[model samples]
Target: MASRYHEVYQSWKHDPLGFWKTAAEEIDWVSTGEKVFDPDQGQYGRWYPDWECNTCYNCLDRHVEHGRPGQPALIYDSPITGRTASYTYSELLEEVEAMACVLADHGLVKGDRAIIYMPMIPQAVMAMLACARLGVIHSVVFGGFAANELATRIDDATPKSIIAASCGLEPGRVIAYKPLIDQAIDIARHKPDSCLVFQREELAADLKPGRDHDLGALQAEAVVAGRRIAPVPVKATDPLYILYTSGTTGQPKGVVRDNGGHMVALKWSMKYLYDIQPGEVFWAASDVGWVVGHSYICYAPLLHGCTTVVFEGKPVGTPDAGTFWRVISDHNVVSLFTAPTAFRAIRKEDPAGAFIQQYDLSQFRSLFLAGERADPETVNWAIDQLQVPVIDHWWQTETGWCIVGNPVGLGLLPVKPGSPTVPMPGYDVQVLDDAGHPLGANTLGNIVVQLPLPPGSFPTLWNADKRFFDAYLAEFPGYYKTADAGVIDDDGYLSIMARTDDIINVAGHRLSTGGMEEVLATHPDVAECAVIGIADKLKGQLPCGFVVLKAGVDRSHEEIEKELIKLVRDKIGPVAAFKIAITVDRLPKTRSGKILRGTMRQIADGETWKMPATIDDPAILDEITEALKTHGISV
Candidate 1:
């Protein structure tokens, strides 16, 4: 069976187009064409250029048409709101149809854009499907974003309408989103024609008369009026969604995903990479704003006729450290996917694994990690705790799906600690030098994808074609520059070292901060840690690390710092020059749990840096700055 998988991979490498044509047959398309890929039309390659289809129909209606109407489609688990709901295929189809009617009734036509800012609820999924059904492009912003961040996305997308909820229930509070939407509209230069609000009733929020309309009322009205909205067929190359990803600069880059190719590629990934079958539950603990949620949570699983869990709770919050375990056991989630940061948090709260052992995780088959590089410590911890194959995969927002992963469906490969295993079938991944030349195995360099990005990959930046070319394609003439620095071993397994910028040059030798961070994370007392390259007059750059200790660990700062320095020196080498290690209460991170190393570096270097809107806590920056100052570093 594993050989069969390898044979398929070899076939894809031999003939990419023919490989895709076979994959494209997995989904229902209105018009399938011979043209597989067109690289000349756009600087970035375009796949399934001459086909036409409606994504919502492929995801929702087809299952119903095939007599699987009672099959589960969406399993929503919102522990924060104390709500749990399930939607069958037929029920979801009807809801999506009604929502499409509501969109049409609001005067939203084909090619229009709608911005969705809602929590992880069924309505959010409905909004996305409704937009796709009507040939309207939807851009989903992370619900945790601030008003100013929301305004920036609004300005960039210039959406015709905004779909949002009045409030979302978090662990200790009911956060009103309607006010934020109103404030974002007030701040944004491009005003929407209308706003559709879902009143959660958890908090009070005033609704305007003419512009703001109730989402529930609109759906009810559509049903009462006997409005029948059919799926609007769009060309294969038509835009599906514009997902904005944060860049190194302040501006966010809107990545555009199209209809036909995206449907094919994602549908393929659900079966091959995730090993999820139809009717099985697949849970990805991520937000809709991120690409992982867009691919796995919303579209891919559904396209494969599987039940995708829309979880609206934290890994530790909605009660205790056993939240994820309870969710997995209660929902019977077969394949669990989440971030390493989440597991780290769980490990921090329950180091003895008592909470996890309380629940029966027999239904769980595999545990997948992404969103950041998974440290070997976290990977091993999860494997031991869960007693399952804990897999780490690497991908980006632009790619829209996993590029390198352990193919649990095909056959589980030998687990490599801190590596994302191997590339998937469609991708030809390589390590390239600064001059775009291929490097030998074990040599660290730029990770590039040889020409012709597979289907489901973003072809261009939304409304910024030249910028896309210059940012991604221009760096390597025929390959897509991933902007990640990494090494591929002789076994062809890739270990993503760090973002090229995160690679610190110390006396001209590149040192991976992620590598050192991974080593530091192995310490039993450490909860979370981040390493940043600080300016040094002697070696050009020096590694400075900040660690968050586990609760109840009463180790002194001096002792912990001394132990960490010696650990790094012994594990990595004396040449690593990892001298400074600071014990901090917490590392500054985003709501999604990515450490703000760049911001930390800025504060340490005394460079002017704006407090990012996505930061989870602003005070942590100040705390880090004060710690740096106390260490005799001139911040």
Candidate 2:
């Protein structure tokens, strides 16, 4: 295994195109064709049409054929109900076959789409794989989204059916997901033909009047038939999924991706970036909805034929913040991939030895941090507390897996406090100015992908190919504009500063407004908050925070400001402890729950904000302006 990995590494380092082509041949393709690059094709220039492979075949059948059918493929845990389950590869295949048979029984055939609004459970994974097996594109929405948001995605996809769980577990709550699904279906102008419901906490009291099917009944009824739905013939470019990205207007962008490309990208990523081994149990703590989970947790690990842990609950549950450690102990996970937000949350609840000692994490070999920025404090905290190398990676929904990462030790050459490390092999990443000229090392500029979009990069926007290209490609010719501000240090290590819209340089140290907001929200009294760095003489720029207290909680100005600073220090580091952290009544956020940091920045910098017509709460801006003046931070 080591020798093969070495060959892959050397080949990739020396000749990326040749290495990827060789890796491409590892999978059984439907056809063999070669068109890796074509500059004239513009945004959609790179197409590999000569190859074809179903994700299920690569993830399941191939592994089973290699004499590893009985190996455990998945382990799941639900903290709320205290339930646990496990599935071996063969057993998982059986579940997928059974679910596929059920779908086929309902006349849903190949080329159909299925929207899965289910919780993090074995059934959810099964349904997804079953859709893959049946050649039905699956789009999964986050279970916590409001009904309107859910309806928009469902409408966009126009799926034939929805596989939903009755309920799901969050921190200290059991969310009724089925009811949400019902509400969405009612609000949806275009509804699916059927609904497959899984009962976890409580059965739906009022089922939407339609072709409502109980998952348990269907599984039980189909088990005796011993039938498997025949796999469909799929091309490499056939749409495999339509992952909806959150949009500012609540209308999500359906990120359509192909099966073969996703397989190639994810397989290579897990093998190279994460060094995934067959027997290893990989645990990416992100929910299945996000891009990270879609790649690492669900698709990537399976594509590599490895065991994975899928927790059907949140990281922080009751019993005083020892939930994640307990899950790791129970599952004996070897690798953990989680967000910096989760790690910070754990630290906020308990930053001592007893909580850390409650579980055995010695089995872990690597820990990956994504879904947000990883500053020095978070990195050092993981290293000191968990005693494992924390790999901080940078990527987006469009780029797919860790295009830039510090691969275990070989790439972990040196650590920069806020840098996201170097780009991985096969990625030609660059930082360029607005005029498309490459910027010098250590010069902050727009991050751009110099090469064509790689595998797992969205094949196209659903019904909006022109819009997709115009948004990503038209901004810069022959490059994919990342819209992220970054800097390549003198040492050639890549450090992502922040989103260009929200980044602020304070004392020469670039900070993400999102990162500061996350830290401020750590205060017990703060229910929500936003932060923006305003101009300052001494520091160049300093952060000014706007905080919203939890209902029925009263906090004084000095107390809130002090707590916010301390929270930033404790969660991140002293560098994040800004000199001007203040509290406000509310913040200006987009309809999709993202804070309008640009507007806040303007407000902090003493500039008038031209409120857009769609501002959800225009009054919030006035409140923020008044509060800042009241706090005596106004210019």
Candidate 3:
């Protein structure tokens, strides 16, 4: 279908405030704001600062009060636990109400901060909504993160309390999170006033006598007391949550989301961006800790009065590679959003896509991929298998939503295999050289968005306005530096290649490692691939390719490596200097599925690097180091 994207984008360009104000009317506001945007406020100005509303009310209570009381609001499917549960709007509202009462009972009130560190469970969703219900700012660190990292967030957010789980279930074993939480609290100077632990059947935690309390017991008590807490009214500018970007170190960088803009943007995204209708099943295959999980999995689907799926399992190994298809077929899902890495993993394991045929995906209309570059090979493979529009979109943790995406809701524009279509209505995306001047079409340069970044984007970092400005705004002066390198085609489609630093200098030429990986991924034997530029004193930097082969491939690694090397050289030309390609068991990634390219590069360069706290498996790094040595490529 031909898209009206041009007309819609022009409408936004013609009247930005008018467009947003119209979108804002869809939300139920306690009181409307006098101004759509107040440029005189915030580090970069604020949105709907004068308005009053409850985000929890919009996402939960309003839906129940309105016509969606009996409609499925959330579906919990955990393959690891062999558990499946569904909550209607009424039931979810009751749960959230009880959770709110629990929070209030714990001495929390409006403006208090709390940290939620838990697995991908229903309680995690309830806790977030409960915090929103009481207007307490919540910060969700990744579930089962290392002790020191959690401790850093504990110190930074300085929460009044901590909501955690006893354990997180993996494929083979259970990860006890209680010990990590204990160590984190012990390491941090600012101890929480209380701790609420949700006990899972797999492992029950030994709660500390004075500080810890069991979540089920408290929730049961709250339910029995017949206490009903109304959603607390908060200014639109009031923070809803503080999400620390993955891989925080000494000082945590928390991305703050305000209540009003968050609802306005996410609700709008559900209808217009994702093309999902209310009451329809929409699944974001992500953890509640990440931004995708926070927006799509927990908030957006519900805000739009749609049923959202909370999946407590991996893309594969939750039984087999077909778990995703099983869930979609069972739930009657309309759309599924997930990282490209997941498809890559599934493609690696089930190269023929045989498992996909095992399910009834008649209701599944589309697939959305993000969180990292969606290589063309994987995108095409999905399109071929699902016979659905495989959309590759781009956004950041700070933005909370998409900057560039093929708006499936807008009637998807022509799918460009390498590009994430065009900028959404809110963003004025530009490709700029180091000097801040906009580059011409197809020119590779740093990506930035014009000043007054659209609604739903972060106003400022939590308690660190200066750092926020310095990190995002200061570099480009009048632009929000995305810190990503990409090219905008003549039609304005964005091809995000890599981080700004990932643009490797080959002798005197700058090349994209992502471009090389795209070429390498086309190889039939290759399941997935990563290309990082290792330090080369002679050429300044050289592209190092790591390819993970598909299952049941008997081809020699040497032969596959040669083919991959040739493929990149032919596709990207000799200028890319793509010489080395190696086969590895797997690529090290974050828990969220982003390849640890920087760490891999650092190791290959023999540079001193600390272990990334967010690594999916630390042992993979050792495997990477051994792979590098076998190739006679650095340490």
Better-scoring candidate (lDDT), 1 or 3: 3
Report clashes for each candidate as comma-separated counts: 0, 1, 0
- Order the candidate numbers by TM-score, best to worst: 3, 1, 2
Candidate 3 lands at a TM-score of: 0.99
Global local distance difference test of model 1: 0.89
Q: Residue 381 CA error for candidate 3 (Å)? A: 0.3
Q: Give the lDDT ranking, best first.
A: 3, 1, 2
Best by lDDT: 3
- The 10 consecutive residues of candidate 1 with the worst lDDT sum are 1-10
* Weakest lDDT window of 10 consecutive positions for candidate 3: 244-253
Q: CA lDDT, every prediction?
A: 0.89, 0.73, 0.92
| Candidate 3 structure quality by residue, lDDT tens digits, 387-437 | 999999999999999999988878888998989989998899999999999
Stretches off by above 4 angstroms in model 3 are 248-250
Residues forming the 10-long window of minimal summed lDDT in candidate 2:
1-10
356-419 per-residue lDDT for model 2 (tens digits) = 7978887877788876666565567677888877788888777667778766534344556566
Model 3: lDDT of residue 459: 94
